[model samples]
Target: MAIVTSKVAGHAPGQPRGGVVQMARDSWVVARRNLRRMTRIPEIVVFGLMQPVMFVLLFSYVMGGAIKVPGGGYREFLMAGIFTQTVAFAVEGASAGIADDMTKGLVDRFRSLPMARSAVLAGRTLADVVQSAFILLVLAMVALLVGWRVHQGILKALSAFLLLLLLGYAFSWIGALIGLSLRSPEAATSAGLIWLFPLTFLSNAFVPVNTMPGWLQAIAYWNPFSATVQACRKLFGNPGVDGAHAWPMQHPVAASTLWSLLILALFSWLSVRKYRNAVG
Candidate 1:
């Protein structure tokens, strides 16, 4: 019993030490594995880029003429919205990816390893972040081509993008929870987009909140999604400012930062807990 217990605890003489460092290392290995998979399947990156590029062109030409924005042309105003939407949509990919692994019995394989259990979710989310960053770079170039200029200096623009990435990271945790709970890639993919559509559309992504009905305006005004969008507009020095008296609109940067951190903490805890139960 003692020998078995020692081996199970992974504290036996020949076993690897377990700690935060080990967890990080295990996570990196898993992240690298996913990254390599992304490389082998180039369609993953190409498809991700296509949607945002289409949105950029579609809005910049088709819808740009119809929408009116304050402080800048529709192109500039649309760029920030495009940026937030792209990163926010990472939730769908995360959910589908995680669900795929679960349904494929990959979770069982990971469980058999003497590695940190949290590393599975951590590594997947990290890989999503890296992929999102690359997509963002390509989307930024597309935005520039459509005459989206950063009125604010480079530092502020960089800061805005960082906040968007942070929000994206937080969003991936929500997806992780969805994937683990659903346990089917197909269902996860559909369920992931179902919630996201309302979250993105009801907010000030494509239209100003004031244009929405009074009650609807309030909801959009206080939305965490809107907080990030507003923050990006302010930081990017673009237009489409919500003149509402809502606290989120008044102090968007702070609201966005707090909302992101809160989402990250809450969903990450829920995801890890769900992961353990799902695979246990």
Candidate 2:
């Protein structure tokens, strides 16, 4: 009776907790479930790949020479921006998927199970990261065919790509929160993209920050998206990386990492709390 009371009161001395391990295992299982679902719906992957590829091709040829970067091939500079945009777009997908699951009672089933409370959100975000990576790979190939070359060494180029994935993972947490807050997938999808247009467009993704007006330039330079784009340009040794003097643009790698990590932490906590309330 004393032992039971002690355990109940959280005074179980010397008893090892398997919460972390169990949570990880549960999260992986959820992630795999999502991945398998994606595979079954082949059009999902195909459409995801096609959108970014289309952007790459259209921007490369139609806008070729239309926008000029002072020091590098506009194509090379455009790839980083397009790549960042594509991964950041994962937030929409995450929102829609979670919203669909909730609407169809999938989340209710998970809630009734023995899995961790965080497993659903964590699993969804993890799956988004994987999907983002696969999309990035295909997009990069399209970029190469369009004359976008990575001048930096392979390792640096890889580091940039990794940062983009990190950004995607971070943003997916926000999507999780959005999906949980909304009632339907359609609403979630619309809410998911509502901010992204400003977040991506207001940043230095497609154009040089210096080209924007003074007030707008400030916002673009300070944007988390801009930080990642500038970081990628520097890592890939592409053009338009040197004009900005802001702290983020000057030290983009650090800024990008900090931004991604900050977003991940804030939204992860919010998402997990939202998940609890959603299922409570």
Candidate 3:
């Protein structure tokens, strides 16, 4: 009998074959796959943009008169919040996609391949980010039709949009974890929204947190959702700027950046860990 020594089937002996470069390549492959699927199912993109467009129209027309924004009209104030809410709600799609993959046994198939484990989740979240950017573009056009303008220069406006995308990407990790834990796509969709309602509603996304009860006000000001909304408002030069005393409201850009980074770090780790144990 001849004894043969070789590296474990997929991995290199001295150094791991697939390190950061492999992860990036594999992640892009997965992202491209998901993006192609979206192109085939156009409804996903259409419906995603539709809901936010409806919100822009309904709120700008119906409640625009009732709401009072400091130094600006309600439509202007509402656009940032609308943008934030729309991006935040994008988690539903992320969760549904991941859940669908798991339910269809695609996760197991991927695990059998010699790819980085993180690629699965990273690709899913990256695909969601691309979808979100498209939605934002459509929403921005609709916002302009409804009389929302970015008074700040183009650079600032771009920054606000980038911040919204970053926030959405961070939130997608939460969806990724939910999808991994849930049994069905339907369940993942429901679970994703259960907490999102309060997170978006309770914050300054719609109304001023100062209007809430004293305790609720505290929570809203400290809420990460609120931080992003406020940052967008400031960067876009929209109205509805209250809570000058609160750290988040005062330094919203920094606050949003910190909150997004923290969420991404925490949930990405958790989701990847869950993914490692999940397929088996």
Model 2 alpha-carbon drift over 4 Å, by segment: 1-18
Error of 3 at 78 (Å): 0.3
Models ranked on TM-score = 3, 1, 2
Each candidate: how many clashes? 0, 0, 0
Q: lDDT tens digits, residues 1-280, model 1?
A: 5754654554444465689998999989988988888999999789989998998898889988998887678888888888988998889888988998999999879877888878898898899899999999999988887788888899999999999999999998899899998978999988888988789888999887777889999889888899999999998888887778899999999999999999999999999888877852
lDDT of 3 by residue, 124-217 (tens): 9999999999999989988888788888889999999999999999999999999999949999999988998888889998877767899998
The alpha-carbon lDDT assigned to residue 56 of candidate 1 equals 88
Compared with the true structure, all predictions reach lDDT values of 0.88, 0.89, 0.89
Query: What is the lDDT for 256 in model 2?
Result: 98
lDDT of 1: 0.88
How does residue 54 of candidate 1 score in lDDT?
95
Candidate 3 stretches greater than 4 Å from native: 1-16
| Per-candidate TM-score against the hidden true structure | 0.93, 0.92, 0.93
* Of 2 and 3, the candidate ranking higher by TM-score: 3
Lowest summed lDDT across 10 adjacent residues in model 1 is found at: 4-13
> For candidate 2, lDDT tens digit of each residue in 69-96?
8887788888999999999988898999
